[model samples]
Target: MTTSATRQQITGARSIVVKIGSSALTELTTGLDVRRLDALADAIEARMRAGSDVIVVSSGAIGAGIAPLGLKARPKDLATKQAAASVGQLALAHAWNTSFARYDRTVGQVLLTAHDVSLRAHHANAQRTLDRLRSLGAVAIVNENDTVATNEIRFGDNDRLAALVAHLAGADALVLLSDVDGLYDGDPRKGDATLIPEVGGPEDLDGVIAGSGGALGTGGMASKLSAARLAADAGLPVLLAAAADASAALTDASVGTAFAPRPQRLSARKFWVRHAAEATGRLILDDGAIRAVAGARHSLLAAGIVATKGRFYNGDVVDLADQKGQTRARGVVGYDAGEVAQMIGKSTGDLPADFRRPVVHADDLVAL
Candidate 1:
């Protein structure tokens, strides 16, 4: 694990993604916080002027809608929440537009759903659109498509969406601006708690208590950590900081937790195949199959599969299970469930004349 001071030394990041939570966007008394919004826009414009590309993933549509709709608090039901989002999204964009107008910079709204990235074609298109927007010198503000997304279809929070956006935009770094300063070893409210500056890998924070943020924000420390993992896996460094300290964090002032990127970067296709896609079925494999698929990095073969679970079509994502029923990996299966069932336990050479391709190609598999 690296210390906070060490992480703060990372500078000169060319492209960055900054995510701000709803709590940081709204006023405590009523309506939106114009000062903070303006300050954030100014900071982003400064970065852009300094030759860095900046993308802002902002959350506040529901919070901003509360005052307009006369709602006392955030609505619990999904329908009401969506209604708030619909009303608030307009206000949110208007706020950014107004703020950025001071510097004569234009802002573009990009709403997305998890499914947008789940499919390969949609993901590629989204990436291209965002890249084009940045190249045109416009600030791209992204938010989840809350108006139409159900609980099952939602990205859950903006943290995950920001990480995904970072990957899509090929950002050099991700800055998650929230209410808290950074991740801590213990809850910050506790007297003995201390900030955690750098996370080398998953094992560093074994028993850290990641407490909930506040009522206005859906994500907590846990979600931010998960976001860090996602960005890190994609080889993008992540900086977790307070929304108030966005400028300092962007300047590498060591005001937040920094999750360093892994040395190896996964291909965009593999990243989408592994993390973005939802698995539709499971295939149980023997020990030999696990070693061949995971250890040797070979494609799954019908002979190694012992059992199949769930109904999945060809090209659907499926989990590879071991003999004990534990999932060892996930991949897109080349054959449908019915076809795989007929070919299971049969040697590659013994397969029926029409079934000869690899069960799950190496290009599709992602080790869990």
Candidate 2:
């Protein structure tokens, strides 16, 4: 996909996820910027009236709390950050609700943790909830469950979360509204920097000097690129534009960067296994097993088992490693770790009467 095609795709998108960064949503002197919030709400409401489904993934809880709590800057520790988020989430939702109320539009708040999307059942359920909310003519406002998420397991930024949400909800497009207009050849603050209007895939971002955003936000150009990759892989185009010009970006105007979607779409299970689920264990396979699993794209068998690591249950996603301990694939297992250990090194015919299923089905597997 080229820049022109990406722009065209953005223009045709009927469903979209618009992510607003903290800097774009907050005031330097006050907590929430009511004026900017109103502008964003108006643009979204107009789109809704036009019959487009829109979901907003907004980041500004901490920034919104800064003024009220008298904090000089964003908190450095997780506890303070969580406290700030708890306080600011209320303010943020209230502002959005109030703004949308003027247009007779209702808003619903949804806070999610990384684990929420990692589990297949939870992932599917979340998607259903979001879909129903949209069907009810309410804009679903989402944010990470920062108060409960630990540092090591956090989504880290709303950019990636928004992308994942777009994928989960089966959105047609993703609009990332930030302070910067779009990606550039170099940092836009530099004299020679030039805007790169479109990205087809990961290859296009090579050598591009994408920079970070304001202090209030965790994401930068790099995170947005990662978000675009995730969305594109899930068969959704992405628009990276300035929040100030959000209406133009959402419209047919080419006011920001756009990343075209891949032509192929992965199945819901494969998408969750590849992008959402966390690996719970590792299964080391022999040479023949590696060839069969990677080259032939077949399932793992007990005869090919070399070793196993970590405790895991049936239906859990696990890393399939080669003899060299390198991850070659990931898939949902058919048996628990203990059961797999008992069947290791045994041929299918020699397995116990109870252990008759394939260890990892091909349909459930995804190559790394």
Candidate 3:
């Protein structure tokens, strides 16, 4: 695990992804806070002018919608929340569009649903669009397609999406701007807590207590940390800072909790499979299978699989876990769950001719 000294590498990254949570975006009870949004745009434009391709991942559709719908607080039920998002997404995007226009910068709104983000083909399409947007000198303003998404509107926030976007855009660094300044040793509301300047790995976060989301945002500090760690593991350094310090955080490395990236970066495809492709099923492997798949880095054999879980189709991502239920790797299953169930524990030579191949090819798998 490296220390904050690695911040030097992120000082002037040519490409970066900056994410602002709903809490920061909707500090005003009325709706989208224009002043804060404008400040953010100013900071982003400055970076773009300095020769960096900046992509913004924003989370405020639900929060911005609360005021417009006459709701006194965030909606509780899924339908009401989606309604708010339906009304709010427009307000949020329009605000973003107009905010960047002040500096004559074009902002392209890109909304992604969970399926659009996780599937292989859809993920590739999004990656291309973001890359092309950067090349055309436009900022990509990404947000969840909340109105149509089922699960995402609840537990999944834009922080995780930002982590995924960082790699999709091939960003050199990621900056997470939220209400809080940075990671703290304890609950930040308490006077005795101290801000943590850097996080090397899980060991450094042993006793940290990251609370849940606020009334306006779906993600809290816990989600931000999860997202930051996700990006760091994919070999992208991340800086978690306060939305008020947006300019300083982007221009320098001293304002926030800087997380060091892994020494080696996984190939873009592998990284996508590991993080973005949400697993649709699980295949339980025996001890020998775990050793071969995780330790030796070999293709998964149907003979090694002892059990299967979930209803997944062929070519869908699935977790390859051990009997102890620990997922050792994620891979694109070669067959449907029902089909895979029939071949479990059967050696290739002894199995039916049509089911003789590896259950998961090494080329389509990533060890966790």
Candidate 4:
């Protein structure tokens, strides 16, 4: 289906990614909930049997490890958290394997770090692996590589990771399962809350205040909304619903809130530059450059650069700032800081042969 497909079109999606939150899969006092796992497996298997490829992004490693490690609550320290993930990952994988085996279907486990999705080569490798697994008739179950990921490399929450995975796998739609049914105009806990049936873009969440999920989960409504936005920006439609409604959400159009995908599909490199990559330095630009890049969608030339701030190498992402220091865009620079310094105020034609082109090509740039 195309990016503009309606929620009714979800049932015909060729490929789908489902993300389940920790709160939906595990209990606070108990660990992994077997009934819930079985239900989710059934839902996924049904979709797969209907001729659509399904990928599951699940969270519950730390929650499952809590009881086995004799911890009274979720660990606060990073070391304990890593230890819990180490102990729980096996259990998590086994539960999924056992559940899927009831249908004689095999499941493959995939663990990823932030770098895996942000770096070009690593991203392509991950996409190839997932594509291969799907072709082999095995449903790929993905989770963050929490055991080895440092704080700097973590995706913060699996919501964002799931969004990136949806993009990488070229999923036609994304389903996020949580405790609540969908986004609300106000806190559902408080009286008189209403479910938001659809969100066209960020402006739909203008005055909405989103709080945290329960103790067992890391993401709240805000995280899920952000994830939905990311996936939608990449031209993937999204549906948010309660975990118990997985079967219906996959087959029915009106079960949950749906977010419409953007009309234009962003290239993989542009998506990464816009959402995942870390900027290395800043390039100060003049008013003419800002208007050209943001308004006219033009490439950034050396003539428009007033100054360069911080060190960066060729092919590294850098912030494109206006004279007032506000970052207007981000792009992959063609030259390092030193090379840029030599041609700062010169036109492309006036520069040496080595520097006779745009500093940051339009294709590599994303307007902020």
Model 1, range 70-152, lDDT digits (tens) per residue? 88788889999999899999999999999999888989999999989887788888899889989998999999989988899
- Cα error, residue 257 of model 1, in Å, equals 0.8
lDDT of each: 0.85, 0.87, 0.88, 0.88
How badly does each model clash, as a count of residue pairs?
A: 0, 0, 0, 0
* lDDT by residue for model 2 (236-346), tens: 888888999988887773787878788987777888888889899999999998898888999888999988899999999999998778898899999999999998888
Error at 367, model 2, angstroms: 1.3
Which model is ahead, 1 or 2, in terms of TM-score? 1
Model 3 Cα lDDT, one tens digit per residue, 134-174: 99998899999888889643238899999988998789999
lDDT of 1 at 297: 76
Q: What's the lDDT for residue 227 in model 1?
A: 91
What's model 1's lDDT at 290? 99
TM-score of each: 0.95, 0.94, 0.94, 0.96
Clashes by residue pair, model 3: none
Note the residue pairs that clash in candidate 1: none
Error of 2 at 314 (Å): 0.2
Candidate 1: lDDT of 25?
A: 92
Model 3 lDDT on a 0 to 1 scale: 0.88
Off by over 4 Å in 2: 1-3
List all candidate RMSDs to the true structure.
2.0, 2.0, 2.2, 2.3
Query: After TM-score superposition, what is the CA distance of residue 61 in candidate 4 from its true location, in Å?
Result: 1.2
